[model samples]
Target: MSSRSNISQYQGLLERIVLCFLSTGPACFFLLINGILMFSLRSKPVFRYTCRYILLYNLLVADTAQLIVTQVLFLLAVGRVKITYAVCGTITTMANLTAGISPLTLVIMTLERYVAVCYPLRHASIVNIKNTVVAIIAAWAVSTLNNVTRNLFLIEYPYEKFGKVLMKDYCTNIGWIPDSLCDDYDRAYNAVVFVSASITVISSYTGVVIAAKAASTDKASALKARKTLLLHLVQLFLSLAYTLYYPLLSALAKTVQRIVFVWVQNVIYVLFIVLPRCLTSLIYGLRDQTVRPVLLHYLFCRWKLSVEPATC
Candidate 1:
């Protein structure tokens, strides 16, 4: 659908190889850290039963799935490997599902923090093991529903146009669907999801700030909650900004030299798409006191963390 890659075809073979190598280095490293953090979350009973930790585990799982799917798509685009609609649909659907789930999970995490800060006395009862589990399930269920609806619209498209056998170009979500409704649905869904998530985070942050001022409140805990919410807001913003991936490149291609356009596209992928997925693990792994030592121990390859020369 995008004859936009006419400039990309002019890129040198050796140059594409180097670009892939450079991007893969950071992608692999982020995936490694994410794996360690995930293992740390399950290696002990503390994480398994705690409400916030359980929520963290769910969020990490979504982010990891998101990272893997996007990376696979990126590799395909880089190699210019065109495939059948069946393959592209499966991969892009997974990408679309994960992309939506991450923001929703982040919203859940934000609300959990808000409860802890603003309603400390009732936090445990309101956000217990059962409810947190239910929240995570609802996030995934909603995202799956969205994916199914979009695919229905996709199936409704008059495939006689492209013949439905093989995609004419490298796969991206917007490229496969030629319908105006699909584009409009995409814009509307993305706007609603991101905007709602952003508002939720901001409201939670505001609640934490207000609670911090009460004489009955614990200022320390509320302060920490504020900072954490801020980080989540930053992450969400980066995710929302990435919706411009195709249009941004298309505009640049028309104005810049081909070589410069290709290089800028590569850098933008790393900055927006690749980097935000890594932030969730880094932020919570290092920021939370309870998870830090265990995360670091596994991150550096040790089974047990030691402080007394033998054990903590």
Candidate 2:
């Protein structure tokens, strides 16, 4: 029994070290790629001005914010350190705010693509720079309202009798809600938003598919429509995974042994939460035609000669 216990402790320590590496590696890479993308966007006026690029930029910003907060939380978790209620609450709030923005921005991107693909003639007038800015602002505002309101119900600051000292080994939403009622409330709120967003995304992508089919005579337009729709679908799938994976893992954590739960949660956090955010910039933003050339030019050809702007 003593030998087994010693081995178990060593295994746990190894797992944590691996988890820390997984968490930080992707985070640094995400920051690097997103930073370069942002710089490329700013330096090239033509790519920066388009509605799609603008929305992509906003998505990148939200993902980066969420990634940073998540890394902080991950480090704290790995250290097994207790944090003050106030500090934990602030971190939770920022994380929730940024996480909320991602789905909202994704929905906006879906709608923008729907318009561009489904109504090619009116895409120019419908999704101009001014309206795109408004849409991005509205996405942030709506996400903020949703997160703030939901968090209010989920957490009670004065958790103890003295109303001052609240400390926990882990800083997470699970700590904030003291009972099942708050849990139910959080679930209900998320359900409504998730369902609504799902409906909108499905409807928009369905329209895009139909439009693409109708434009089969124009090979170039149809191909572009299909490619864009496929990318949107992948993003939507990742968003769904990011949103749902945590709740499921949290529920499972309650039923498992402490050692098992820790390992499971760490794996799920890195795989579902961190990996998707890092991939968003690569899969969605960098692969984009307008942005890709700028990235390539900066990394490869910037010193040699001037690169002509690509048509939107």
Candidate 3:
């Protein structure tokens, strides 16, 4: 491409930078409020004891991590400076690992809800605190193994004339291999993660719907089932965006076109990852009436005003 073409290609980068800044400001604001809410409710008995609450809390934590990672890396990318390999490797590994695991954790939570609504008799025994903790541990383990294995194979030194540097900045899976092997591996990984989540979601929803049909007379159960389905649907769409963006990245290689791609990717991350987190607190507020009273009580009590709660 000519110099003019290069300039045109990178034109989108400026627009993206503006959008990222706009999105980041709100994301940070949401994170601040969400963090306060999470901490305030941390000790509450309902949040402490419920399996669903634990899952939701984990999701929020993971999303918060995503927000932090993306914002910091994004700033660096925009500045266009050199990044050492060590920092890049670790950040890349952690970001991808955590982000990938979160959706799978959501899948597990969906299954748990399915069992609760579809097979109430087994819900208590199947999804108690102990089992819930074990499930979370298993999820972390699986996600760690996937990232570590993939990174280990991909990250190695290039001898005099033997191998070449496999990846570029920030643990991103970039290589100069003219072969399709790496692509195949990526496709396989995507397939496994996507297929697993899809199957779990389909089965869980099918079970819920079937159970809802049979128990239509129970209005409360039906309503709970519908709410659960809606939440899962939102999560599925967000995750699908996650699964799709990576494959389409290459098509945006023109310098100017990449600007739009970069911003779109960041915006998508906010919508899919960060919004779910902010929505968690909101969802709790809307779905559980008890949360509102407790939250309001925490915010304001009948005690006489003193120096100020900020000091305390």
Candidate 4:
């Protein structure tokens, strides 16, 4: 009996170590890729001056931060490392706050594309450097407001009763949910953001298609703009998956065996967390003609650079 118990413990520990590697491996890769893309964005004058590239840079910054926070939470959960309610709350709040920025940035990017396609004559004046800066600031400001609202709701919890208390479960955005009121607030906020953003992107896509058919608006450019808008919608779906993956895995845990739950969680984590976080890098890093050569130059440690800038 003693020998059997020892073997079981060893197997479980080994399994956890492998799981951590499986999950963190891709996250680290994406981190490296995003870092390169960020550097590439700052490497050229055009990237710095263009409205859309500036927004892509903004989006990458938020996604990278969120990815780091997420990896920390994953490590804590897998290693069974205990954390206090205060620590958990702070970390989870940061995660939630950063997650909100992606969709907002996407909405802004979609609108920018709409303007460039439908109203090319005024695109320059309408989406200038000053306006782009303000849009990015407004995105962060809104996310911060949402963060503030979450903290306010959290203050009502009776943390004083249990001073310096460690949370029972692993630290997560959903770990120590304070009250139903906060949950309701979160749901409503998410719903409004998601719906409003989706409608904006989809509507803009429709308008761009109509404009392409009616006017002589650079057929190739219009086609690419429509494709980019569609990619934005896909990105929205991936971002929403990040928000809901934890609750979903938790609910599934109740129905499955422990071994099954662990495997499913790992798979879903890589898909939801790893895949989406790096998506921005892949989209603009490789897709944009102007960015590709520069991004590749950075990715290869600036060893070679010969390609001319092309249309994004």
Candidate 5:
């Protein structure tokens, strides 16, 4: 029994160490990459005005907020720290607000791509910088309102037998709210958003593909259109994976051992949330033809300066 107990304790410690790295490492890297992208876009007027870069910038901001919240929760869990009801509630609300905004933003991005690809002649008027900025603000406002309303029902001060606020692994809706309500809300929210967004993305991408195929007279333009829509589909799929992550994590928690549950949860969080957010910088920002050249040029200049001998 003693040996088994020691083994279990060590295993838990190992899990915590791994979870800390998984949570913080990607977040820091994402912040760095996003900073570079933001600076590059802001410094270049051409990229700043482009609808695609504007949408991507908003997405990066949303993802960074989500990552910061997630990392804080991970730190609390690893340290076994209990927080006040208000603090926990505030963190949970912020996390939900950011989480809600991410998918909505992605949906808007897909719609923007649809307009740009399917209605090339009107794309400028329809998806300009001004319209993109307004859409981003609307997405943030709607998501914030929805999450704030839902969080109002959260039970922030749930207590144990000794009349102390119960500590939890993370500040989450499921941890703070009644199980039934949490289940119902999650199901309703996921069903409505996931189904609606999936339909919009699929339909829009289909239109884009069809439009690209029909415009075979400009073969290069048609090919570029198809490729751009394909990237959008990839991004949509990643966002869908993130949407489904919570329900899957809940299911696993009920069935798995304590150690197994923590391990799986951390892995799921990193893979579905962190990894996809990092990939967005690569797929949507850096690899973009217009942005790539600017990024490369900036990096090359910085590199050249570091290597050149100092002037006498």
Candidate 6:
């Protein structure tokens, strides 16, 4: 290889390292705030019946998972391992689990919102503590099952070519097990999961917008509902787009794609997963009166100042 090529590769590696630093730090901060919010609300009885609390809890959990896995694994890659296929595979699976489950939770949350706003009378009976726990358990269960089933489809294979040559470092000789046996099965399963989750989220939120418009007797209530749905729609778009891109890039290219894919993956981790958790409390705090008061109470306490009368 030429010196120029070596320089370029080194530069790219440096860029990835910088990107990891920029991404992971902010991601961790967001995850920390999310943890605080989740724990704080756990003891609040008023928020127990609301969909916001449930959705917030799920969002925090998924983003926290993403931050921990990505941050630690990337650090490990930098400090210890040389980024082997096995290491990369494990990271990819964990990242996918965090990324994939996020959107699914969004779908469920939007559906929960739809039911609450559309059918206010039945919201209480349907969205109780018992049902919310069940729903959360089911989401985690389904996500785990999906990851296990998909990872099984990928098999590592060794390659040799031109008789008497072991091609360990070359690109062409090193290969996956079989396209027919593994690629199609994995792609089909993942596509189904991604498409189904995206459609479900979008459709449920669309229904939410409609129901909000129809049910709101006042303009202010309708506007508030619209704003919340809009924010969720943006999140849904970001998640779905990345979920589609990651698999597409992996399937199409073999080498040189890592530069683009790795960076893009980091971007999604920041934008879709991390940014939401950091900004969610702020978003709700700035927009909603109820959230603002709760946040203020937590942050700024108005303790009574006792003083003796001044005797001059």
Candidate No. with top TM-score: 4
Global lDDT of each model?
A: 0.83, 0.74, 0.64, 0.88, 0.71, 0.59
Q: What C-alpha root-mean-square deviation, in Å, does candidate 3 show against the real structure?
A: 6.6
Runs off by more than 4 Å, candidate 5:
1-15, 155-169, 215-217, 297-312
In the range 1-312, model 3's lDDT, one tens digit per residue, is 599888976875676567667767878887775675565456466777778777767776776676677566656655554465556666766767767767777887888878778767777888888988888888888878877666555445443332333334433335222235556765688788778787887777777777777844355775676677667667756654545544445555454366466666666556655665566556654465555555444445533322111100
Q: List where candidate 4 sits over 4 angstroms from the true fold.
A: 159-163, 304-312
Consecutive 10-residue window with the lowest summed lDDT within model 3: 303-312
Q: Over the stretch 1-312, how does candidate 6's per-residue lDDT look in tens digits? A: 699999998887788678768777886666666665665455455554565676666776776676677566545533334444454556667766776666677667766666666677787787766777787778788777877776665534432322344323311101212345555655675578667766765676666667656645344654565567677666666555544443544454465476576666566556654565456556654466555555555545533322222110
TM-score of each: 0.90, 0.84, 0.76, 0.94, 0.82, 0.67
lDDT for position 298 in model 4: 84
The alpha-carbon RMSD values of the candidates against the true structure, listed in the order shown, are: 5.0, 3.5, 6.6, 2.1, 5.9, 8.6
Ranking by lDDT: 4, 1, 2, 5, 3, 6
Q: List model 5 lDDT by residue over 149-264, tens digit each.
A: 67656545344431345545555556655557666776787678778877887888678777766744355665665676677667766765666676787899789897788778
Please estimate how well model 6 matches the true structure, expressed as its whole-model Cα lDDT.
Answer: 0.59
Q: Per-residue error at 193 for model 2, in Å?
A: 3.1
Q: After superposition, how far is residue 302 of candidate 5 from its true place, in Å?
A: 1.8
**Which parts of model 6 have CA positions greater than 4 angstroms off?**
1-20, 48-51, 76-80, 83-91, 154-190, 201-219, 244-282, 296-312
Ranking by TM-score: 4, 1, 2, 5, 3, 6
Global fold similarity of model 1 (TM-score): 0.90
Clashes of each: 0, 0, 4, 0, 0, 0
Worst 10 residues of 1 by lDDT: 303-312
Q: Which tens-of-lDDT digit does each residue in 1-312 have in candidate 4?
A: 999999999999999999999999999999999999998887767787888989999999999999999999998998989898878888887888789899999999999999999999888899988999999999999999998887787676786843498888898766667577877898899999999999999999999999999757889989999999999999998877786787788798899999989888989899998899899999888998878888888888876665443222
| Clash pairs detected, candidate 3 | 9-255, 9-256, 10-255, 10-256
Query: Mind giving the per-residue lDDT tens digits that candidate 1 earns over 229-253?
Result: 9998988887666677777877897
Off by over 4 Å in 3: 1-20, 159-180, 215-217, 246-249, 255-281, 292-312
Model 3 lDDT vs. the true structure?
0.64
